[model samples]
Target chain A: MVPVDYYIILSAVLFTIGALGVLIRRNPLIIFMSIELMLNAANLAFVAFSRMYDSFNGQIFVFFVIAVAAAEVAVGLALIVEIFKTKKNINIDEMNSLKG
Target chain B: MTQTDFYTILPLTVLAVWACLLLLADLFIPKDRKGITAFLSALGLAVTLGLTITQVGRENLGFNNMVVVDGFSTFINIILLASSLFGVALAYGYIKRMGLERGEYYTLMLFSVTGMMLMAQAADLIIVFLALELLSIPLYVLAAFARPNLQSEEAGVKYFLLGAFSTGFVVYGTALIYGATGTTSLGGIFFAASNGTPGLLLTIGAALLLVGFGFKVAAVPFHMWTPDVYQGSPTAVTAFMSSGAKIAGFAALLRVFASAFPSISVDITAVIWVLAALTMIVGNITAISQTNIKRMLAYSSIAHAGYILMAFVPYGNKEVMPVSVAAGLFYLVSYAVTNFGAWAVVISLEKAEGKGLEISDFAGLAKKYPALAIAMTVFMLSFIGFPPTLGLVGKFYLFRAVIAGGYTGLALIGVVTSLVSAYYYLRVVINMYMREGDPTIEREQWLDFTTVTTAVATVALSFVPQWLFFMASTAALRLF
Candidate 1:
């Protein structure tokens, strides 16, 4: 049986990678994928905790989170498509002229 | 399982039902009748605002301590809903002009309001994260709702990316704290914190969570996205994000710190103090250099966030928490009204067909649109903390609270930065009255009416802040 700490550490690593991807990547799609990765990391932690404690509350929360993440992905992808149509480029740095 | 639970969630339920109805209603309504959705949203928001006021002093936990309905939540809820009402009114004509007058816009706005209300009431960390997403997802779409505008699209993408980045921090932090404490309940965390373990995991978790919220509120170091996103989004959406979203962020921060991590939060008090000071200085200084109206206001929003952070200086188990809550609450109301008025001026004068927001474009507005120029002047003055305005009263009360709490240095920084803010604020006035140029813009009748109504209320409220201050004082009392 694996120690609970091992699961916790693994999830943290995945979350950090997702954060780094979100910061470093310019493509809206990739940034979005990073966000999904982060959410999955959170779900993984939730499932781990539920299994550790033998409680249903953490699993119930994971269900709601999955629902909300689905909605977020649909809306986020639609927004990215709209931006791509207008800007014709997904480079994050190219969008910096909006300052005063 | 009492009647208060029903009463507590009554306003939230009202908003949800109205949003669903509006979503379905939009499918059948003609294109031109989009104004009806705005009107209905305004009415629904107003009704909820009234309902929230009825639950002001009632302190009850709904859904097993997951949701708290109390004075603090009610106060911020009123501010959010009031601003949303103003936003719907402000957006109605702008949407028609831009040809983005769809029901989705109104529905998204309604959904965002639901999220904000939830943010204020959430007692559990899990609920807070859910509420944050609920608040953010709609805003990301709204930011890019301008289909063909490249800047708008870019703003949406940037906000989405950064927003998602911050969410990761919050959730990971939450997971760590849950791991250490074995529960996600706010009360459970507080109980654990009281034991004074201050585990490394809990400390890192709390810091990461602050980073996430700090980004949301647009504080100094985490505020990189604010000016860009504000400048790119539509003017009305910018106004909503500035007022409504900032309120939610502060409310959530207060809950997490005040309730969840009170033990080790003392170690963090110095860091918050420093952030507050830096946010004030950086925001005001950057705002002074801005040539565009929206971008300047964005920076101004950052400065106001700094002021809200001052409330946190007195937050951690101090005798001054009540005063801090009062100051934060009052400032929120003042910002909601004043910022809405500023955006109302922008929406009114912008070209009926396209962009007309260069600060130079407002030259000689005093001569052409005296009413609007006067309104803008009032908002700027209130924002700068001029006497006889609610802004002045709010700032006065806020700094008094700070000084009473023995943070005279922080109070002094607030005063100096506010004075610095006045220079740029007055630049708008100087252009309107002192400079010479032509006002070539024509306003639509509805937009014209909105400008007049907002101007009148701003001036009228500036004169009689007693009513507002009285309500705020009572609301502050209810928090304790």
Candidate 2:
């Protein structure tokens, strides 16, 4: 049988990779994809724990999280597209005109 | 369970229903009739605010203890509803002026408010997370609702990215806490923390949770997105966010920390103390350097968060709980009104071409628009904690509570920084009265109504602050 800590470790690693991508990637779309990966990593942990603890609540929470995540991506990407349409660039650096 | 008990959730339920109706209205309403959406949404919020006031202290556990009704919740509900009404009114004119009037704008705002109300009432961690997303997702869209402005679009993207980043931390922390304790209810967490030594996992979870809440409240180190988002969003939306969103943020902070993790070690309190000190210093100092009025106020908002954090220093201490909670609630109410007042003036000064937000633009404003100059001066003085203003009374109580809690040094720091804050606040006044220029900088005329009313409210409350103080004290007592 697989150890619980192993699953936790793997999920943490994936989540870290996602965070790095968000920090390093210049493209808004890639940053968004990185965020999705981070969220899915969280889901992995949630499902792993649900299975370990034998409770349904954790799984139920995952359902809500997925729904909200989907909503967030849809709206977020739309805004990004709107920005790209005007600026002709999807790079985050090009959006610095709003700085104080 | 009982019929009267069902009425306890009336405010939240009404708001949810209004959100759905607004969504439908958005789909069917013509572009020219978008003003109807704003009016309908405002009416719904007004009714909810009335219901909340009438239902105060009618405690109930609705939807299986997920939503709560109590004095604290009622107080925040009133503040949120007031700000929401102000936003809708301001949006009516601003939206039309910008030619971006859309039914979806009001609908998203109503829905976002529904989420905030839920966040304030959430007793379960799962519910809190869900409510938070509900609050955030709509705001992301609204932040970018001005599709023509590239700044608005950038604001939406930044807000979404950072907001989602924080949520991941919050959820992971919640999951860890659940792993440590057996349940996700705040009561259960409190029982576990107080009864037993908080284990390693719980400690880490608690710290992570603090990070998450800190980001929401825009405390220092987690505050990178605030100035950008506040400056980039439409001025009316900025007012709603600065006031309405902030109240909900603090409500959640108090709920999670004061109620859920109240008995944690002094280490946690120490961490909060450092955050308060830095938030005050950095927010005020950065604000002084900002020439852009919106960015300056955004920093000022962060600094005000520091003052509120002083009220939390005495949390978990038995002798100081009363004064602390009272000071916090009073400060929140005062800050909400004063900040909204300041933003109302800023919005009135804004043109569709995005001019007049610079601090120098207000030069000779007193000559062109005497009433607006006077109102802006009142807001600035109130923000600076001058006497007779609600802000002065609010800060007096907060510092008193901090001193009473034996944090005299921190209180002294707060007072000194407030003195430093007076410089920038006075700068606006100086420009209004002393400098020479034409204040022909114009926008929607309707903004004058909100500006005048907010100024009057601030001035009027400055005189009759006793009632507000008493209400805040009463609300504080109920919380303890």
Per-residue lDDT for B1-480 in model 1, tens only? Answer: 777667768899899898999899888888878778788878888888888878877788887888888877887887888788878877888888777888788899999999999999988888899899999999999998776887888788789878887887888788777766777888888898778677988888888888899999999999999988998888778888888899899889987887788788676788889999999999999998898888888999999999989988877646787767777777887777788888888887677433668777788999987877888898899889986566887788889888887899999999999999999999999999988988765466655666666556656776776777667666666544
Clashing pairs for model 2 are none
Per-residue alpha-carbon lDDT of model 2 for B235-297, expressed as tens digits? Answer: 888888888777888888887777788767576789889999999999998999888899999
Docking class of 1: medium
Indicate the TM-score of model 2: 0.96
Instruction: Write candidate 1's Cα lDDT for A38-85 as tens digits.
Output: 878877887787788877766777787788888877877887778777
Clashes of each: 0, 0
Give all candidate RMSDs, comma-separated: 2.2, 1.8
lDDT, candidate 2, residue B94? 84
The alpha-carbon RMSD over the true interface for every model, in angstroms, is: 1.6, 1.3
- Backbone clash total, candidate 2: 0
User: Residue B451 in candidate 2 has what lDDT?
Assistant: 78
- lDDT by candidate, in order shown: 0.83, 0.83
After superposing candidate 2 on the true structure, give the runs of residues whose Cα lies further than 4 Å from its correct spot: B1-5, B441-446
